[model samples]
Target chain A: MHSALRFIALDWGSTRLRAYCCELTPQQELVLLAQASGPGVVKIVGTFSDVLQQVIAPFVKQYGELPIFMAGQISSSIGWFETPYLNCPVTPQAILHSVCERISGQQSLYIMSGLRYQNPSGDNDTMRGEELQLLGLLRRYPQYLHGQHLVCLPGTHCKWVLLDNGYVSWFKSAITGELFDVLLQHSILLPKPATLYTDDWATFTAGCQRALTFPNESIVHALFSVRTKQLFDAYTASNARSYLSGLLIGADVGSILHDTKVESLPTGSIILIGSGALQQAYATALTQANQQSVLITEQEVVLAGFAAVANQTLLPLSCQA
Target chain B: MHSALRFIALDWGSTRLRAYCCELTPQQELVLLAQASGPGVVKIVGTFSDVLQQVIAPFVKQYGELPIFMAGQISSSIGWFETPYLNCPVTPQAILHSVCERISGQQSLYIMSGLRYQNPSGDNDTMRGEELQLLGLLRRYPQYLHGQHLVCLPGTHCKWVLLDNGYVSWFKSAITGELFDVLLQHSILLPKPATLYTDDWATFTAGCQRALTFPNESIVHALFSVRTKQLFDAYTASNARSYLSGLLIGADVGSILHDTKVESLPTGSIILIGSGALQQAYATALTQANQQSVLITEQEVVLAGFAAVANQTLLPLSCQA
Candidate 1:
């Protein structure tokens, strides 16, 4: 049961595989000295042994198999193996066992379960990457999110999860991103520029403000105004910013904040994940809506989550027990 | 002047232009005789005279003047003549008029003014084409739209206009289309290969219904489920219908139906102007939304609108007295 054993963490996804080598020094502190990423879980198939060998190549030389664990889509049915999800309201034991078969003579491999949420609406739903991010968010802002907190992780399918007293009570996901894409390009709005250029917080915040203020006209008028402005005023492709920000945030607020008392949500903050324009857009939305804010990095949380599972699955028998 | 004179109406904008010619049947009712279109006013500027001659070749032979009138962006500053916009709450007298002589005294032209909507939100917005379409929508459903009515014209910029009696009282527009475009394509769920296939009004209505019931999550999570169903369960591209249906309608309900009595608006139900997919998307939304609906053709409204203006402007004294 060496607490000092180097703990290896992996953040594997559709595109790339990244790993970090971490260990506790004598003062009992975790240090990450090396990290690397390669062509990810999507490229590999039933050849889990070969895929993993390539994935862990960077860290294998430094730490052997002192202790390791993984996260991301790498554990999905299509990735290394079908790691059945743990129905959440999960504890340590609620975690799913990995379906990985080991090398001829090697340390055991354990994969954490992804989370599935039954929409009370009778829709089947689950999330693998974000719940780990939520877990990481809670660890970072434990005191701030003491009661019921709603975190918005914006992306392809933007997720809004409810964290009641640090245990996920209910959560929902929306495909704001996907809907936006099909509508803009394929719909009548094309023949205009392919993209808007105002990639700043002001654009996003103004959009969020519009969303909170007028849920209905917010998106529609916002778009029409872009054409109107371009035709009538000094509008660049940038005017699309306020409209874009308004649609995503406004739609989120519309979908998530129904019958919700603005004053009552736990510490009243929305956490936004992802990076570049998206993070800023969420930040803009939160500030405009006067809701509190927290940002958990998309990459870091996945990394920490892998480490969290590693600490739980591959550490000492006593530590894991 | 012969009130029996054959007439032609044109609506031109940045991307496209269209014209409709109507002859007074022996019965004295306007009947469509011929129609044509090309790259709108912006592109056909230099050849305006030649195109005008070719367009009205039939009418010119029948009547010497061949008086023609245009509307929408044709009257905008970018229009061939730069006819300016009139203030809101205006009358026919207030219309900014521009006259042009094309093809060396070959044809006489008049362009119409666009409407300006100045509301409390400081939205001094304007519309070129749809107002005429709404006028035609009213022409058809005079019983429903004659009184106070809320008109929902969906497109890149969806419009929510309040009409007092027959005149437009005030209106607002949003970029629901652009948001839907960017979000769907560029965001995470872009994997679904189906292009803008028709919407599954059932799923879309469910989404719309979900929006009215739980407005908060309508925008974000509403989209992803479609993709998941497609990816995991082999949901057809048609299944993306619910996504589009939900998105277009869900966003409409979520963004527009705020603290106001979203359940009910003015009695006219929703009057949709855009055609094909956009129109169907709105009809599905209005159905789920429990709103009566009417759709006006893109071609007819713009043409009828030009006729409406021609009725007022070309021979103002004959009708005014």
Candidate 2:
């Protein structure tokens, strides 16, 4: 039996650290061998190195001294080590070339730097973790390589990336998920229900439709409708949760597609990278907005991106490498 | 010496109660004799009647069994006594006719029912205390009765009412202030500054200008720019608060003005009923939106409204007939 090619990959974000032990298969796919997760960057009580060492202890014990790679906010300013943001119009190769390397005792570690875009008016926006997901998407399906495409990775900060000729041409970030969370917890509208509403597509679609139909700058007014709808008995408190989600997601999608810089892009076949419920919601919203979208699991994209960067570390060293 | 005409008027709302003791002069002007304030309906630990009695004890002693008038959320379902909503398109006379009365021993109390608007599509929105403010505006300045005037009362629930043909033809509420509060307290953006920035009109107006220029539903997108702006050092933590405020307020004004129904209304000289810092902020936003506005103090409006409603109670009534 051919010994499995092994490596350790971490998807470390603001609030959680997910460690993955993976093996490269003969079919050129990265397969997860074992996985563990601990507190994210914010929750770590001790130095990041200490917590990281503890998290990967099992993986290292099982497979001695495997090369490890970290992505996302772990490489951000608040992370274990600060990796500078790479200016956008970056290709997958450029992203790979920007990885920062460090030695922690016996461990070899690589971290992917985030992407920053300076707008025409000189405003800067940065994205660190999502770049790995984008790189993974491009590598997994090279078909998206040749043309301009919209890639939306929905999370706390939903990223709307324009992939022009296989490079991150420009992107915008929407605080959709974070806003939703804050509103649900702190705002008067949509108080947490006695029991979570599992699936309420009717109100969700209605919310999505409202966002799509309303004039683009009227979101503040539209949001108040969530409360009025509940007060009028049009929606129960339970279902209002889904409605709130839909309104936020729908607004994000609507604004992203309607943005002037993005209006020129091809309308159909946007790639949506999200997981579970968020994925379903965005897909439903995209459909309601009359846009075609290709759904890709966030897990697969993250892993593929992590594996690509890990595999790069194994390449033969050159004098100018 | 002639004894001053005496009555008790309370502007009782969700969080606080402002009670005013006023006398009607021989000149037919209502003058402020004395005033006091205490816990509003939501904060009252004991029965509202008990609280009211305590609040007006000195007034009752000075003038025996004075008629009391209350307006705002204190008359709503959650307040001392539940008063049903009076439908809009209501005149000052209609508002006076809708006051619900109660008697505690020798003390007689009158509470104004809030205004409720049911859209053609059957959504119900109710406004309590603001009706008094709107009424105060009309009674205070009868000239506004002649034509369509946009009366914007900026506060926790900002009310944008159309005073058409001497009546409240229609109105809409935007959760601008409440949203701003929740966002400041709960969201990652705009953490409360250790020291207030005091004034940041440059960034504030930039935010307002952004709202005016962007499409109406793009507010969700513009809001995120608050964070990105800070991330890039474009704004300090202190100034960002104003920017966030501008974004919300500007979006509100933009959407209210841009709505198809009110788009036909004359745009100049909006009646902006607010007080203090909020009034200044809304005025700034309105100017950026290319509209002229006249500022009216909320204190005068609420007090005048209470006095107006109280005047109605005295007419056609005699000690024994």
**Candidate 2 lDDT, A1-321, residue by residue in tens:** 233468888999866788999987646678898999998765689888898889999988898778788898788655788888888889899887778888877667888899999888776778879999988998888988888899989877788899998999999888888788778876656644445666688888877888887744376667767777786666877678788888888889888777888778766698999889889999999888888889999989899898787666654332125
DockQ numbers for every candidate?
Answer: 0.30, 0.52
Model 2, range B190-224, lDDT digits (tens) per residue? 64445466668878887787788774436666787
After superposing candidate 2 on the true structure, give the runs of residues whose Cα lies further than 4 Å from its correct spot: A1-7, A25-28, A38-68, A77-80, A102-109, A192-195, A314-321, B1-8, B12-28, B33-69, B74-81, B102-109, B192-195, B314-321
Evaluated against the true chain A, what TM-score does chain A of model 1 have? 0.73
Error at B243, model 1, angstroms: 4.5
- What Cα-based lDDT does every candidate model obtain? 0.59, 0.80
Range of the 10 consecutive residues with the lowest summed lDDT in candidate 2 chain A: A312-321
Q: What's the TM-score of every candidate structure?
A: 0.71, 0.89
Best-performing candidate as measured by lDDT: 2
lDDT tens digits, residues B1-321, model 1?
Answer: 345545777766545667777664434356677777766654564676677667667655665555676766666654565655555654323342323333337456666656777666554678665566666555545664446666677754567766666666676666566466554554444343547665565666655666556554444555566545654556566665556556556666555656253335544455666778778777776666666777766766555555555555555544565
Docking class of 1: acceptable
